[model samples]
Target chain A: MSAAASSRSGARFWTWLSVLVLAVLCLVWIYPFLWLVSASFKDPLEIFSKGLSLVPNALRWDNYVRAWATAGFSTYMLNTVLVTVGTVLLVIFHTSLTGYVLGRYNFIGRKLVIGVLVATFIIPAGFAIIPIVDLTKTLGLLNNRWGIILALAGSGHAASILLYAGFFSQLPKELEEAAVVDGAGFFTIFGRIMLPLAGPVTATVAVLTFLAAWNSFLIPLVLTFGAPGQRTLAVGMLAFVGTNETDWPGMAAAATLSLVPVIVFFFFVQRFFVEGVAGAIKA
Target chain B: MSLSHSAIRPSIRRRLWADRWIYLFLLPTVVLVASYTIWPMFASIWFSLLDWNGFERAGRFIAFGNYAEIFADRLFWNAFANTVIFVVVAVPIRVGLALLLAVVLNAGLPFSRSFRTAIFLPVVTTAAILGVVMRFVLDPASGPVNEVLLQLHLITQPINFLGRAGLSLYTAIGVWVWKWLGITLIYWMAALQTIPADLYDAARIDGAGRWQRFRYITVPLLTPFTIIITLITVVEATNVFDLMLTLTNGGPFFSSEVIDIFVYRQAFAANIPRLGYASAAALLFGVCVMAVIAAQIVVVARLRRRVAEQ
Candidate 1:
């Protein structure tokens, strides 16, 4: 009984030790973000002077004022919202329709389409940016917000489509058959019955797509090069750093502005994000 | 044969007619994917063959010349080498750390969920923004890292984490691992969830210790997921263009340049944008990535089949 008690105590000791270690690691993990927020509140001199201290000597609201007004973060925020919302809607529309059909039907070219989709997965879309840029320019969509939205959304979200297909495939076909018997057309059934049933999958896709579009950097950078007004928050932060290289506090403020919303959004929808990633891997 | 053909033809036509709506539903996806993904893939090959600047509508076709030039370029090799190093160094560290963390987090410890949220908060933050913030955080002069080091008397002088040529890539890799460790942790946690608790219980009942149970059962069961998580981490490590670009911009004598940055610089950032050469580099790198992916797929399939057999 004494030996058993000792072993249990040892186990408890190890468990608490791990918890302590994890708590410290968690602080270190979030330190950069915390530091950024801290610096955002500090004056430029104090920011460098306060070294490693998370608390500011004084709360300087001018950094935010500068970031919002002078650095054009307000506009960037709006552009990010527009692009993210548009991309999310477009992706849902595309993936749902494609996934619904692929999941339900055995059409003539079904195998061929699936094959093409799978093959494209091997080609990382980052490498194809040059041609995409050229193509977008050719289509007269370059330097346009709609162009950014389209390019962001138009990339074949094969995983998302596959996710929807996996979800839709498992659903009872009797629902569709019954809908058809009740004089429902394909679009009607898809819009009303099928889509409504795919609320979880749609939420997953939306959360994933929203995060991607919101935080995407390179495409928006290149696409909005000449059109500064169209720059997303990610790209604008780079541009902000470029111009305000010496304004560390303001830069931190701008970084905080760009990051806080997305972080908050993640906190709210992280359950879906976690599940979506898990679901995609399983699929 | 003639009668069979006639009978089949009519049914095929009827089936096609019935599936017209399905085809219509597929139209927008087809158009978008073809325009952006499929066409551009072929276009990269076509563009790689031309002696073109990005400004030109058409350039003189110089078949394989760009490929030959890329093969000869020293900078191309530098970027390629750096990318390989980044992938080689980053994937193992990221995957290994994530697995360990996942095991710890999956232990059902108190406040495990909160720890996960804290760790995952960075993953949701913009890499570009983090890149910008890290510069200040790691600044050799009056930065927090240097201040901490100085206070601890760890070094006589502050180390330039991003400025030094030898240290920049590794610093970037470290930061990359920090930002992305959460996703891999999640992958591992998900994988660990698949293991039945009864197996552990059975092992414990059969006089198994914790380490022995882990070694005998958990590790074996986790083999498939490890391969998958490793591959995913490898792919993700390769695609750190945004973070790398924002952080170092492949600076301090191009010490930190990855292949993506190399292509981006040549195609977009250079004084005279070399579209053809950049396309060649991209194509070459794309082929390598594809090969690595293909090899992983084959290995995974074979391993999975073996495990199934066992």
Candidate 2:
């Protein structure tokens, strides 16, 4: 858009310069992951051997073998998957259902429910860990997968419910009215009309919830303290790092294994991930 | 029964019965959520009054003794101070750098999408594991950072990044920012998009330079969003124990301890395990949290009113 040829060239130069700078910075930002991956593949003795380049001297599978065996990565991965999938499923079901009814119908005590949920959503649940532990014990749920699932999923999902509620509010009433006109009950309307159309928020809730449940540490640590079979990835990784502190290649392999699933998930769902993040933030 | 009383009671009962469908949908959620959230809230208060370890059931009730002990503890205060310093130092840098990146990325440069995704990788990963992985990446002897510096002949001796006294906490903050900056950038991006292009175009029509447009036009419109983002950051920062737990273990010499670590160590890591004192510390932690919620209500309420007025 510059009038003069020299100024146009200058503008072009600035744009290229900015792009070049940003690209370099992104490389820097990504360096840790690259190095982690490379280090994991390197021979244990050669990981620190003369390299700014990301290539390993020999692409060995030994670290992975060592990490998987030592960290009990298979069991940890299985436990994490069970808990994450279970929690995500429950959260989606509960939040979507709660959001629809609370967002739609003006029934008795609805205002009170909304008020209480909103008030409590902002508080950090870590403060209540002690009682939660006691509550789990009373319910005979300690060291159980269901206990961890319920603990993560059920409590303090007010934020997600609120997201769904806001979304439902903006949806046109004509759909619900037509459904009612066609003799649909609340359940049918919710199932056939609302939930079907809640793709964006559902995707948002799914990704965010999955990420949180997958990555959670402290609660899972408390709930499954001595239960080796029940340990999530984060806690398992911690123990792996703890025991394998000086074993750089093995630790790197463990970290890489733990990170791979989420990275892959994000890779495929990049569009939805971006939309989910921005959408939830805006809501 | 009298006719009038019988009639009124049935109407009230039927009205309630009609709304059972709503309650049916809400039943499992309310039970699960309220039992967890509401019950534990009251439970924490009660727990704070006792002197029981994690294993014991019967314990002496020392009504305000836990709070009294916390008040007298120097470590608790040190933790509190360290947290405040971390927030005071780290948050501004994070927020500023995020805004700058967001503005630059919003310029719609070639390959901006790839750049954004590359930066966002860390956000998808857990912060605690980053702490674990980073220990290797920043290790004084074997870390790439040291290796690169040595090759460049920048330093004769490797820097003790995470093991030093004063530098360890800053290292923690640096790592925290690296993981979190992407999310903040996304927030800023969402906010920036809400500012209309015509305003920028109008400023340009008036012969305003890039800096001038950013100064007079952009800054004014971004104030509300800035407040919201700052409050959210502060709220999130208070709960950052796991990073210190995994990263520094609040160490080199307990130099990186935050309030949450103090509480966690008390409840879980202590010899006798002072669950009561931990509860008390958590209650104080709850105060910091309450301030966060209060800020949210005020800003959100004001923003809503402003939107309505507009």
Candidate 3:
């Protein structure tokens, strides 16, 4: 009885030890973000004066005002919303249709299409940016929000398509057969039945796509290089740095502006995001 | 035989016509991918063979000229070396740390959910913005990191994390890991969930210690996932353009110039943009990446077969 009690105590000791370690680690992990938020509220001088302390001398709402109004983050935020929404809608529409067709139909060239899709995955987007830029420029899309939207959406989203394909293919054929028997056409069957049934997959795709489109930097940076008016928040942050080089407090505020919405969005849909990544890995 | 082939052709045509809406549904993706992905892939190769500044409607078809120049360019080689170092140093650290943390987190430690959210917050945050934030966070004079180090007597003077040539790349790599470590942790956690609880219970009943079960069962079971996770991390490490561009700008004497930065500088940020030369560098790097990916795929296939045999 003493031995069992000792072992139980040892387990408790280990659990407490692990909790201590994890608490420290999590603080370290989140310190940068906490620091950024605190810095945003600190006076420009106090940011340096206070050093590592997360508490500011006083709240500086003016930093946010500077970022939002004077620094033009408002415009950047609007552009980001427009571009992200456009990209997500386009990706979902295109990928779901392609996935539905590829998953359900046993058409000629289907294998070839899948093979091509898989092969393209090896080509990273960064390497192909120049050509994409050139193509976009040729099509008069450079400096246009549509250029950012199309480039983001048009990049062969093989993973999203595969996710949808995998999900749709597993669904019993009887669902579609009944729709067909009820005199449903292909568009109606897909629009009403297959798409609604793919709720989880759609959610996964939307969350992932939204994150990508929201946080995307290089493509938008390059595409909007000539047009400052078209700059998304990611690119605008860089311009903010260039213009407000010494405004550390305002820079933190700008970073917060770009980050806070996405963080809030993530908290809401992180479950789907995590599951989407796992599902993709399994596929 | 000719008569039979002719009869079957019409039936195939009819079947295709019956699924015409399917083809229509496929049109947008096909057109988009072909224009943006497929065509550009080949166009890059074609551009790499030319002498163009992107303003010219047609580049001079100087076959192999750009390739020859890239072979001789010292900066190209430097970028290549830096990329190799980045991948070699970053992948193992990222993957291994993620695995360890995932194991700990999966042990059902208190506040695991909150810990995960904290770690993953940076992953959702924009990398470019983080780069901007990190510059100040690691600022040698006024940054919190140096201040803390100094107060603890860790160093006599501040360390220039992003300004010093020797230290900038390593700093960028460290920041890159911090920003990205969350995604990898999630990957490891997901992989961990796949291990059936009964195996652990069985091992425990058989008098296996905690470390022993982890070493014997978890390690072996996680081998397949390790291959995949490592491959994903390696691939991701190569695409560090946004962060590097913001943090270092390949500065302090071009110390942190990965190939992406190299290509971007030459193509867009140069005094005279050398589109062809940039294309050549990108193609060469792309080919190397593909080779690495292919090698990994082969390794994964072989390992899977060996595991199945067991």
* lDDT for each residue of candidate 1 in A37-150, tens digit (9 for 90 to 100): 898999988875655778888899999999999999999999999999999999999999999889877779999989988887777876679888998798898888888888
Tens-digit per-residue lDDT, A1-283, candidate 3: 6998999999999989988898888888888889889999999888767467788878999999999999899999999999999999999999999999888777767898899899888887766788889999999999999999999999858988988888888989788778767998788988999999998888888988898999999899989988999999989999989887889999999999999999999989888787777766664
Give the poorly placed runs of model 1, Cα more than 4 Å off: B1-14, B303-310
TM-score of chain A of each: 0.96, 0.91, 0.95
Write candidate 3's Cα lDDT for B205-288 as tens digits.
Answer: 999999999999999988878888888899999999989999999988888899999999999998878898999999999999
For model 2, the local distance difference test gives: 0.85
Residue-wise C-alpha lDDT for candidate 2, range B220-252, written one tens digit per residue: 899878877887788777878778888988888
C-alpha positional error of residue B287 in candidate 2 after TM-score superposition, expressed in Å: 0.7
Model 1, global lDDT: 0.88
Clashes of each: 0, 0, 0
What's the lDDT for residue B194 in model 1? Answer: 91
Query: Where is model 3 more than 4 Å wrong at Cα?
Result: B1-10, B303-310
Q: What is the lDDT of residue A94 in candidate 2?
A: 92
Ordered by DockQ, highest first, the candidates read 1, 3, 2
lDDT by residue (tens digit), candidate 2, A1-283: 5468887898799999999999998998999999999998987668756566788878889889987876698788899899999999999999998898777777668889998898786767777788888888889999999989988887878888988888898888788778777998778988888898998888888888989998888889889886878888888888887776778888888889889999999898888878766765665
What TM-score applies to chain A of candidate 2? 0.91
**Model 3 local distance difference test score:** 0.89
